[model samples]
Target: MESYGFIDCKDPKYVDTVKAIERELLFDGLLFRYKNNDDFGEPKSSFTVCTFWYINSLFKIGEETKAKNLFDQLLSNSNHMGLFSEDLDFKTKKC
Candidate 1:
């Protein structure tokens, strides 16, 4: 959406995409990159970048309050150095 400049526009497709992402990837307010099992095993963590994208998507879709709340929650899960890893544990939120 950002690459195509669709983030600033209130497009129904963007809204639908956000809704679909929320329904399929969102877990406990965090966003997972995928649900399928890879060669290693089923994914057990949420991708930090994907969650960040979700935050932006929420704000772009007129869900500012939700976006802000989720942003704060994400921040709170960060490490003592105020850094997030590529992935966060889904249940415990450990990096």
Candidate 2:
């Protein structure tokens, strides 16, 4: 499987494209939902992977403060056992 950001052949525009996609995923709700259309045309109720990706992307883009904020948000999604399962219900604010 090809990785999203891996570039075996260095293209001058590669980094720019990756950064643009990352920013869009982080900030554009419409694009995010559209990309994950399989999950009810949006994200699942609990999405640890998505949350983690957001944090990772922030760090990759040199936004340490923003990355920390996203990290805190992901941590907040943990359950009573300090563990995050598969889904987080945004409406109920529970995982």
Candidate 3:
């Protein structure tokens, strides 16, 4: 997919940005939108769309194998009907 911006995917900054996101946002095989306390206090669930976008970014940055593995892991956590909610509990994997 096109980056939709001037920054090339191969650029060190872009790669490093993605790496930083993974380092700070990824948790328990899922991806949290952000860290730190918010109005609701610290986040307790993974933001589904943020995780998907991160997985896509991983693929765009040449981490296809890792992205695929994460994709599968996330998919496996979906409900039996193959549906996902906006948020998923970190421990229970429930919506």
Which model scores highest in TM-score?
1
lDDT of 1 at 51: 96
Residue pairs in steric clash, candidate 2? 45-88, 46-87, 46-88
Count of clashing residue pairs in every prediction: 0, 3, 0
CA lDDT of each candidate?
Answer: 0.90, 0.55, 0.90
Tell me the tens digit of each residue's lDDT in model 1 across 27-63.
9978889999999799999999999999988997889
TM values, all candidates: 0.92, 0.58, 0.91
- RMSD for each of the candidates: 1.4, 4.8, 1.6
Residue-level lDDT of model 2, residues 1-95, one tens digit each, is 01465552135354465467566554422113224667356664545566576566546656679679768766776788888766556555466
What's the C-alpha lDDT at position 51 in model 3? 91
